[model samples]
Target: MPATAPRRRLTAALAVTAALTMGVTACGGTTKDSAGKEGGATATGSADPKAPLKKGLTVAYLPKQVNNPYFTTADNGGKKAVEQLGSTYKEVGTSSGTDTSGQVSYVNTLTQQQADAIAVSAQDPGALCTALKQSMKNGVSVVTYDSDTNKDCRHVFVSQASAEDLGRTQIRLLAEQIGGKGEIAILSAAQTATNQNTWIEFMKDELKKPAYKDIKLVTTAYGDDDAQKSFQQTQGLLQEHPKLKGIVSPTTVGIKAAAQYLSGSRYKGKVKLTGLGTPNDMRAYVKNGTVEAFELWDPAQLGALAGHTAVALESGRITGAEGQKFKAGDMGTFTVGKDGVVLLGKPTVFDKSNIDEYDF
Candidate 1:
């Protein structure tokens, strides 16, 4: 199942319950979720947990782009969290084809909309810093996800996984596939991506171990997370280094593109592809034997954690400091960390046998 399926069903349930009860319910009942899991409700359970019951407060979630599968799944988590809190939630951002200018315009529009809080995944952290700062000036709570605008502009960041953890994990996976020998190339995102660069540096550091002494990093290419560009880069790397044994693509788009190219060429089984990707995006590649494994966290759980954390902080139940713990609804509990950022959990590796079990 797609990651969005469960949340979509939850949304439908909320609507149906509202209609049947006219937004007023006895609050005690048993409900079945999209996964067919049963949930018990108390008599006082809010019909819409995130209904903006405060009367004048509004929250907006802005992904890097509106139609991207990853962000769409994340928005569902945010909406579910909103429902749990009885607050109103709106998803605002550019469409799938939008660029940086369009994202900036969306930020400005949200500001004009006078949203009480804005959660965004900035396309260009530096470029959007100014707009995020302005939103702060307008008394909007600014939180960033996937990509952060900057520490100074945003109050909190929802990171999927730690940079070092992801980088080290990718390096380990690549080394294991190639027997720790031969040349490998890195197909990363844009040069300015804060997360990607950090991961690349960690990969280099991890490759220096004694077990990886024979492994050599030949070159790194930037695909900016564009599928076509990643494909072209993968082809170029093959020509540039005929001895290449493996390729690591830290970006989801780059990883899938590399897998697609490798699957159709002589590189299948001769070279390995490992990085971050969704189960749906990499299912065929893994089954066709082009990719051995990849790593990622649950986007829904990450978004749910962010939503709950935001609500907790806004409600004065938790602070963006050490020793603070709050419930993330179905995501469990998390603690606040330094720099006002919260990491979801460790990266998980998915291979052919287990890929089907993961939805995000």
Candidate 2:
């Protein structure tokens, strides 16, 4: 639901991510209530949408994991938009999605480079706060996409869509696939990933409804956003819960890997699987009868919007205030909602019938 980061992935290396203790609630979250609180680095001037977008500005992008194909797609989209707007675009980050130290270091480096702005997909909600606040204090605008930092750390956050929407939809999709009665488990990315955790929170809340009472949540397994690890986790889930009716893997990496395991095993077709995934990654599995459908927004569109948001911030078009709006190039106008968030749009469901129409 976040990115293709299959391009929606993060990792167990939460251990490596500032050595953060691995637990969803223990670590800080990027909820709007907290991000909306005043006091942190922010744009103080009023927005001027008609102001000429300043050219030749340096905008940096730091994705969660550099090598993931989905992130690569999202970054390229940003590069395209930034260049179109007459700004310079470059990317920097660690190869590992869970490298919190690398992420922090890159933020510091971007600030030192005197970059006009930085677009990041935070690895941890709070671990990167100090560094990000320092950047804001240095007059560098920070915009987060895909995942978010605490509202206090950055000037703006570009989310794929509402956290509640992404989370609740996964549960609905799985219930339909499993006939509304059976065991289900969530396969997630890093424990500290704000996006993943937020979506999971809504998923759990949705399950509390009477419509989903028949469905029992068995457990949530962490795959650390690694292919082999995800595959192993899927296999283990089945081994441990022979009655497991379905799996909801929110990250592209997790869903694809789970699809891979189910495709080759006896569970193929018998077990339902759904979550965020890129069309290309899931096409084979969908054709093979391992999965019925999955969901994601165009990661490129998400990145491009972020690029425009960053440029707008530097150009003084908006100052991260609720109700302020800006045009995102050809994508259209977007409004800054609560917590300085700009949502890309709703999730799109891709199945065998329409998967071919999508390429990214």
Candidate 3:
């Protein structure tokens, strides 16, 4: 059930950087995010779709850096949905995924250990929004999966898709592998990652359409997600664009350190690489051809829908508004669109014919 692509509606340009923040890209440094709003999280309750999931209640994952196999398969899929809804799952963070003051002191030590939901992944986006809106004004339940924060810092954000469908599907999968034209470039991750600057503003509004009018784009190399600065910013973007034909790297540690610097240089298979990686870290650079496709999602079903949307927002069943619907047990019924976000869909692209049928 993790192969998606059709569903789009949440519009009106919902800001607070409308959701996105995959994993495996850490190391830090960058700020300047708060454009006003600070602390005071509101949203009291009343959605009761049979409100039954409220067991031992503790849920605290907080990622952006940890033992790191993609946030350890998304905090072990939020410790398998907070131990299958009986709750009480814990994991804390900060090894420098832009250590926003160690993710604001691990959200004040998981709100002084009263932990009733944290699930963060932000590393700036208003510098952890006043300690996650004061850990939702002390009652906890914040939920901001994979790299988000700034819809006034969390209450619901599980998104892994539709930042204009992952920036026009990473520029239509690198303009269908550099055919529709040439000269691409993006590298990215940590220009104060508002989900890679909202998917590089829809990959620069999908290269202004017209079927990407002969591509172009040419520069943008940030690699602060560091793997020796994304292998020396993929060798300073092919030595300052030596006619560079491709690259997108929307960060899975910048497309496996720019596919280990184009599978050991001489631009293996002559440039052309796509963004967002991890099918076991781009399976030997897509079996030695140095990547021809890429995309992501199913970081263990995006940490099991951010552990069933933080146990369905502490089981009043759903309160994060915008068409609230619930049930995520077997990974199904999830609605709540618009700025409360919740969109785990449309991502799978891999390559080498299904990238060996996926594993990460």
**Top candidate when judged by TM-score against the true structure:** 2
Pick by lDDT: which candidate is best?
2
- Window of ten residues with lowest summed lDDT in model 3: 9-18
For each candidate, what TM-score against the reference? 0.81, 0.89, 0.35
Q: Show the lowest summed lDDT stretch of 10 residues, model 1.
A: 36-45
Error of 3 at 152 (Å): 30
For model 2, residues 1-360, the per-residue Cα lDDT tens digits are 322324322222112222211111221322121111222334345678787897998888899988677787787788779999999887878778788998998887777667778899998999899998877776777899999999889888999988999999999999999999999999998888999999999999999999998999999999878889999999999999999999999999999999999999999999999999988899999988999988988887888899999988888788888888899987889998887889998998888878876777
lDDT (C-alpha, whole model) for all candidates: 0.71, 0.84, 0.76
Candidate 3 residue spans exceeding 4 A from truth: 1-5, 16-51, 55-97, 100-102, 113-115, 122-222, 225-235, 240-270, 277-293, 298-304, 312-347, 350-360
Task: Please give the ranking of all candidate structures by lDDT, highest first, separated by commas.
Answer: 2, 3, 1
| Local accuracy of candidate 3 as per-residue lDDT tens digits, 144-230 | 887788886777888788788888898898888878898888988778877888889888987987998988897888876767888
Of 1 and 3, the candidate ranking higher by lDDT: 3
Q: Give per-model CA RMSD.
A: 10.3, 8.0, 16.6
Where's the lowest-lDDT run of ten residues in candidate 2? 13-22
